[model samples]
Target chain A: MSARFVPVPTPETGTYWEKAAEGELWLPRCDSCGRAVFYPRSFCPHCHGDDLTWFRASGRGVVESFIINHNPAPGYEQDAPYVIALIMLEEGVRLTTNLLGVEQTPDAVRIGLPVEVVFEQRDGIALPQFRVITGDGASG
Target chain B: MNRAAGSSPVIIAGAAESPQLGTVPGQSAMMLAVSSARLALRQTGLAWADVDGLASTLPVVDLASYVGIRPGWLDGTVVGGCSSMLHVRHAVAAIRSGAASVVVVAHGESGRSRVGMPPRAVDPASMAGQFEQPYGMSGTFSRFTLPVLAYLHTYGLSPDDLAEVPVAQSEWAAGNPRAYRDKPLDIHAVLSSRMIAWPFRVLECCPLTDGGGALVLMSARRAADLDLEHRPVTVLGSGESCEGPGASFMEDLTSFAGFREASARAFRESGLTQADIDHLMIYDAYAHVPLYGLEDLGFVGRGEAVPFLRSGATRPGGSLPMNTNGGGLLYTHTGMYGMFAIQEAVRQLRGDAFAAVPGVRTSFVQGIGGMFGAAGSLVLSNT
Candidate 1:
C-alpha cells in the first residue's frame, strides 16, 4: 500500500501531534466555558477566551457516525471500502478518524460502538486513530 | 408589484441560465459566467456598462474586465456552493442601501470538464487536512454524506426513506427538458444503483456538469424606470448563516443549525410562514439535503421529511411544488449550484419555468454550502 497523508503541524497544533507520538491523547480545555476543543486551536471556539489549557484525555470515544467509502482518497486505493467515522469523545468533543481493528462492514461496525484511540506513525508523526473496544474495556 | 412597499423592494429584473448548460467544454468558467450575465443583462434592457455592482465566486476581476464593467460595488463572497445565494442576499442589501443600483450575481463552474478551473487546494497544516482528509474521507461523497447515517439512526429511518428524495424529484426532472437526468426514476432503481457510500447510491448524487446562471437585481423602482419586458421578481426576504468548518463540527448531525437559523431569519424578515409559500427550491446537491431542508426550514417536523417527501407533497400537482426545475440532483449542478436554485425560483414566480407550477405567487429558495458548513435562504414573490 502507498503511504497515507502525513499532517504538517502548525504552531497551535504541534503539541497535539507531539503528544500523540508519546502515546497520549491531549486536548485543549477552555477556562471560561469549561469545554474541551478538538483539532487544537488558540482559543475557545465556544467563548473566544484566549486562556486555554491542554490536558491528556481518557483516549476513549464512541462511533457517532460513519461511512464505508468504496471510493478511497489518494494513497488509499488499496484500502477501499474502509470505515471513515466520527468519534465522539468522553470529553464532549467529536473528531474525524478511521476505525481500526474491525472488518469494514455494516454488521461489524456500528454507531455507538465504544472505541479507544490508537496512533499510526507516518513520517515521524503519530496520527490518532481508533479501534473498537471489546470485553470490559469501555472507558469512563 | 409592490406588496413589500414598506421595506425597500429589491427585485430580480432578469435571470438566465447560460446558453449552454450540462456540458460545454468549449467555454472556460469566465466565458460561461459572461455568457449568462449577457443573457440576463439583455432581459433587463441594460448593457454591461450599466451594471454598477458585480458579485461572483469566480475570478471577479477577470469577470469585470471581460464584461466591461467598472462597478462602484463589488461583492466576492465565496462560501463554497452556496456562494451565489449569499451574493444575492448581499446584492439586495447593497441595492436597498443605495450601495449600487444595478447588481448582477453570476456563477459558472466546470465541475466536470475542469477547464480553466483552479487547482483544488488543501493546506497541509489546516484543520481538515490534518484530521478529516487523512482518514481517507473521499471528497463530497464521503464528507457530506457522513451525517446521513446519524440522521437516519436518530430518526429510526431506513435507506428507503433516503431513496424517496430522488424518486420524487425525478418526476419533476422528466418534465424539464433542460435537466441532465430527464428520465423518470423509481425507488427500486435508486436502491439498486451503484452504492457510492453507505445509505447513498449513485442515483441519489448530483451529476458533475458544467453550467452557469446569473440574476440581475435592482430596486423595483429602478426596473420600472427602464420599463423592461420581464416582470420583476421581488426579494421579500433573505438570510445567511455559517456553522463550523466540516460536517463533524456541526452541533447536531441529525439537523443543521445553520439551515434552521438562516431559514428562521428569512421567514421573520418576510413576515411569512410555511403556509404562505406556494413554491420551494431547496438545493439538493445530494438527496439528503432536501430532507434536511424541509425539516430545518420548518416545512415539516423533525423526522417527518422522509414521509413528507414520500407522500408526493413536493412533486408536480402537489400543494407546495418544489425544485420545479428538477433541482441539482437531476438538473445541472455546476459545483456552486445556488445560482441555479434562485433562477428556478424566479422562473416559477414568472410562470416561465420549463415545468411550470400554476399560480406560484411566492417562492422560497434555500441553499447549503460545503459539508453543511453554511446555509442561505431567500423568500421571493411576484405580488
Candidate 2:
C-alpha cells in the first residue's frame, strides 16, 4: 500500500511548492547579501533584506551526509527502512531528501557520495529526492 | 580585569527533580515543572517571591509565568536537547546584569503521556519544513542515526561496545534512588533488547520521560545573604554555539565542531583544563553522545573514546566519574537531557550526589542542542 497521503502548504511557502510542481528547485537568493536561501522566505534571514529573487538550481550535488533509517516514522510505516540524505548543492545550498535508487545500508552509503536530484510525486506534490549516479563507486 | 571585585557571584543555590518520571500518568507538563521549581526553592530556603527573572525551555513558559514570576526578561529558548543548558547560561547573564537578582532555569516534558497538543502542519515552503522534513527526516532519532552508524564503521566498534554505556550507567542507576531505570542491566541483556534503530537498541535509547528539573541562580552578593546549607557551586565559565538547523551545514559528523568550540571556550574562560575536572556530567541522550562528547571536549583523542570506556575511565572512582547520577541512559530524559547534566554537576559540587566523587572542586557539563546543531558548555568550580 502507498504511504499515508497529505499535501500541506502555507501561504508563506506556497511559491516554493508551486515551483517544485514544474520540476524546478527554486531557491531565494538575497539581492543584498548574495546568499542563496532555501525553504522559501519573504526576507533574507542573513541580512533581513527584503530584496530577494527566486532562481533555478543545477539539481546536481554531492551527498554530503546521509542516514539509513531502520525505523520508520508514523506516517511512513509502509517504508519501514529508507535512506535519508543531506545533499550539498553546487550553489552552496544544502537540502535534505531521501536517497533513492540505492540500498539502505551502512555499507551502501558513505560521505561524499555523488548524487543527482529526482522528483517523487506524492499526493500530486513533486518531492525532491536523490539517487546515486550510475558507475559511481561511492555507492557501495 | 576586576569588573566588580567583590560583587555578588551568581551560583546554583539548589536543584531538584520531579518524583515520578518516565511512567507517570495524568501529570501535565506544567505540573512537573512547578514541582521541580518548588523543590528547588525549598532546598535553597527560599520562596517563589524570591525569584524575579525566569529562564526556561519553551515548553514551560506559561507554567513559569503562572507560578508568580514576572515575565519581563524571560527566555524560552527552544534549541531542542540543549534547551535547559542554554537557559542556565541566560540565567547567569540575567543575575550578573541585575535584571533580576534571582533567576530560575527549569524544563519539563510529558512526552509519554498524551497532552492532546495538535501536530503542527508542515509548511513546505519554509526553510526547514520544506527542505528537510519532507525527505523523511522527521525527528532527532532519524537524523542522529547517520553519525552514529558512521562512527561505528570508522572505529570498528561493535554493538557490544555501545552496550557497555547503558550497562555501566544502569549499574550507576541501581544506586541512585531517583533514577527511573534502577535495575542492573547486564551487557547480554542490553544487547538482547529490541532495536529501535540500527546500532541502537531499546536500552541504548532514552525513555520518553515525563519529568522536570530546576536550578536557582542568584547574584554572589545575594547568595551570601541566604543561610545556605551547602556551599554554592559557582559558574566559572559558560559558552554556547550553533551549527544552524540543518545537518548539511556541518563540516564533519564524526567531529562535533560546535561542541568542540564551546568546550574550548568554557575551559579557557574557567582557567581549567580537562585534567582539572574532578567529575563530568556530559549529556547522554543516546549512548554515543558521551563517546563523541568526550572526544570533542578534548577529554579523549578522536576515535579513542570507545577504548577509554572499555578501560573503565568513566565509571565511579575511575579516571573521570562521568554522569554519576545515571545520566539520561538510566535517569530520566524529558527530551532535554542537557539540563539534567547541569543539575548533576551542581549536586556533585555541593557534595549531595548519590555517588559523590571526593574532592570534586571542579565539574564540567556539556549539552548538545539539535542533532549536533548547537552546544552549550559550563565549568563549575567551588572556589
Candidate 3:
C-alpha cells in the first residue's frame, strides 16, 4: 500500500516528531502559566511565555469527540470508514488523531473511551495515533 | 464602548444579493461581488463614485479596480465565513473616524462551481497541516463538525435534538423564494438523509451554493445627503472575537467562548438586552451552530437552546423570529455566509423580506468563522 500524507515539522515542532520516533510522546509545557501546550509553538498560548519546556507525557487519554468519516482525504481512499477523533490527553491538551484497532461504529467507539498512544510511521515521519485500552492486552 | 455605538451613528443604506444566486456558474467570485455591489449602489440610487471605502474577503484593490472606484479606506480581515460581519464592524469604525464616507462590505464565493477559485493549498509547516489534517480530517464536514458529539454527550441530548435545528429553520425557509431548500422538513427527514458526518446528516449541513451579497454602510448623515430610497438600517452595535487555533483547541467542547465574548460586547455596546430583540439571525453553516449561538449569545440558558428551538420559538409568527431568510442551511451558503445573514437582517428591517416578520424593531445577527474558531455579533434596529 502507498503511504498517507506525512507532516513536515517546523523549528518548534521538530523535537516532537523526533521524540515520537523513539516511541515517546513529548509535549511542551509553559513555565509561567503551569499549563501544557499542543502543536508545539515558540511561545506559550496561555501566558505568552517563551520559557517552554518539553516533557514526556503519560501518553494516555480519553476520546473527547470524534466523527466517522465516510469521505477520505488524499491517499486515504482505502482508509475510509475510519475514525477521526479528538483525544484529550492526561496533560489537559487535545490532539486530533486517528482512532485505530476498533470497529468504526457508534457502538464500538464512543466518547470518554480510554485510549493510549500508538505511533504510525509514514516515510521517516512518526505520527501519534490512539487505540482503545483493553485489560486483556488485546485492542478492540 | 465600540465605535458604532459610542460615536456618531452609521447605518446600512442598502443591502442586496447578486442578480444571480444559488447557481451562477458563469460568474467568477469577483464578478459576483461586483454585481452585488452594483445592485446595492443602485438600490440606494448612488453610483460607484459614491463609494469611497471597501471591505471584503476579495483583495480590496482588485475589487476596487474592477468596480471602478478608488477606495481611500480598505479592510480585508478574513476569519473564514464570518469575515463579512467583521467587515461591517470595521466599516463602522472607518466611517465614525471620518476615514471614509461611504463603505461597502461585500462577499462572494464560487463554492459550488469553483469559478476562478484558487486551488486549495496548505502549508506543510502550519499548525493545522502538521496536526489536524494529518488525520482523516478532510474538510469542513470533518473539522467544523468535530465538537458536535461532545456537545450532545455533555447535555444528554440526542441526535434528534440536533436534527430539530434544520427542522425549525426549514419552516422559515418554506416561505423564502430564494432559499435553496424551502420545503418543510421533519426530524425523521433530517435523520434519514445521507450522512455526511456522524450525527450530522446532509440536511443538517449548509448546502454548497454559488452566490454573493453586499451591504452599503454610511453614517446617517451621509444617507440623508444622498437621499437614499430605503429606510436606513441602523448599526446599533457590533463585536468580534477569536478563539484558539481551531475547533479541537477550543477551551470548552459544548459552549463556544468566542460567541459569548462577541455577543456580550455587542449587547453592552448597544446598551440593549436580550429582551429587546424582536428578531434573530445566527449563521447556521451546520445545524449544531445555531444551538451554540442561541446559548452563547445569552438568549437562552445553558442546555436550553435545543429545547427552545424544539418549542418552535424561532419559527415564523413565533415569539422570536430567527433565520428568516432560511439561513445558510436552507438559504444559499457561498462558503462565506456572513454577508447573507446581514442582508436578511437589513431586509427584515426594511419591511421587504420574503418571509418578513411584522413589526420587527430589533434584530440581532451572530456569525461564526471557521470551526468555532472566531465569532462576530451585530445588533441592528429599524428605529
Q: Is candidate 1 or candidate 2 better by TM-score?
A: 1
lDDT of 2 by residue, B154-252 (tens): 777765688878876765678566787888888899899976665677788787677778888886677666887677889888888887665555566
As for candidate 3, its clashing pairs are: none
Lowest summed lDDT window (length 10), candidate 1 chain B: B1-10
Over 4 Å off, model 1: A136-140, B1-7
Residue pair clashes in candidate 1:
none
B140-190 per-residue lDDT for model 1 (tens digits): 888888888889999999866788888888888895668998988998888
Query: Model 2, A39-133: lDDT tens per residue?
Result: 56778977999978888877778776555566675567767577777777877877777777778775787767778777788878887778888
DockQ for every prediction shown: 0.77, 0.35, 0.77
Worst 10 residues of 3 chain B by lDDT: B1-10
Chain B structural similarity (TM-score) per candidate: 0.97, 0.92, 0.97
| Separate clash counts for every candidate | 0, 4, 0
lDDT of 3 by residue, B189-208 (tens): 98899987787788988998
CAPRI-style docking class of model 3 based on DockQ? medium
Write down the TM-score of every candidate. 0.97, 0.86, 0.96
